[model samples]
Target: MHEFSLVKSLLRQVNEIAEQHGATCVEEVKIEIGPLTGVEKILVQEAFELLSPDLPGSDCRLTIIEVPLQAICNSCGKSIVVQNFQFQCTACGSSNIRITSGDAFRLLDVTIDTELTTGVTEP
Candidate 1:
């Protein structure tokens, strides 16, 4: 489903980055998951586990960073933040609003080490 496609894309990018630095193994993979992205954490983790084995990085660790939902009111133009999927104007009861943040999924950073012949390096 959605997880499959997203994971496929993520794996491709991860492998490319890992190969760029002559890295034979990736130690960590950090990704940002926005609230409006509508992605399940467990499903994403499962997909990564299932898909990453065949790639360049064998023992890669996947870390997900969840972002909260934030919106702005169209009437008063007030900024409002919510932990979950709640989008309503606090100052004015306006249903007409725009999402200022959240609704994106991106690979923020990756950790790979190729110089180590025995163990991975820390920086």
Candidate 2:
């Protein structure tokens, strides 16, 4: 499944981020996915479960946020949420519409655990 590749890429990104911050452990990774993204949530989860263990912080948790497909009606000049993948404008009943969001997979944020050090001075 394509989800495997996507999840692999995601883990790679997370690994890079964790390294950049000198994180001891990766705690969580959050992502936003929409219907238009053509990505199945369950498949992505499975892929992550299978592939994440090979990378650092194998215990990292993945959070998937579902967002609705949003678009702006060029005919009515109204912003609306597209339902049933219909490209027509609800208010004007026109086919002229511009998609605004919910079209791609987006990485929201990553949470990591880091080590903190404090220097002590002895007089």
Candidate 3:
């Protein structure tokens, strides 16, 4: 599945971030996924489970946040949370709506553990 490739890329990115921060271990990786992102959540989780161990921090946790599809109506200047994949605006029933979110999979943030000179770990 494409989720495997996506997860692989995500791991690589996380690893880079960890290295940049001189992290002793990666703690958590947070991501946001939308309904239209075309990636399965379960598949992504499975892929992460399969591939994350290859990285420095095998115990890194993946946090997936589901975001709602949201849009703004151009006609009425109203913000709406789209339901059932409906493109029409709810406030004014306008088809001229601009999607504001829920269109892609995005990396939100990464938490990494760093070692202090005093021989202690901090995040």
Best by lDDT: 3
Residue-by-residue lDDT tens digits, candidate 1, 1-123: 598899899989988888888887888889988778878989999999998886664777899998777788889988877544556676787867888767778899988868766676677
Q: Which stretches of candidate 3 lie over 4 Å from their true place?
A: 118-123
Order candidates by lDDT, high to low.
3, 2, 1
TM-score, structure 2 vs. true: 0.90
Give me the overall lDDT of model 2.
0.87
Tens-digit per-residue lDDT, 20-78, candidate 2: 98888888889999989999999998898888786566677889999999999988899
Give the runs in model 1 whose Cα sits over 4 Å from its true position: 116-123
Best by the TM-score measure = 3
Q: Could you tell me which residue pairs clash in candidate 1?
A: none
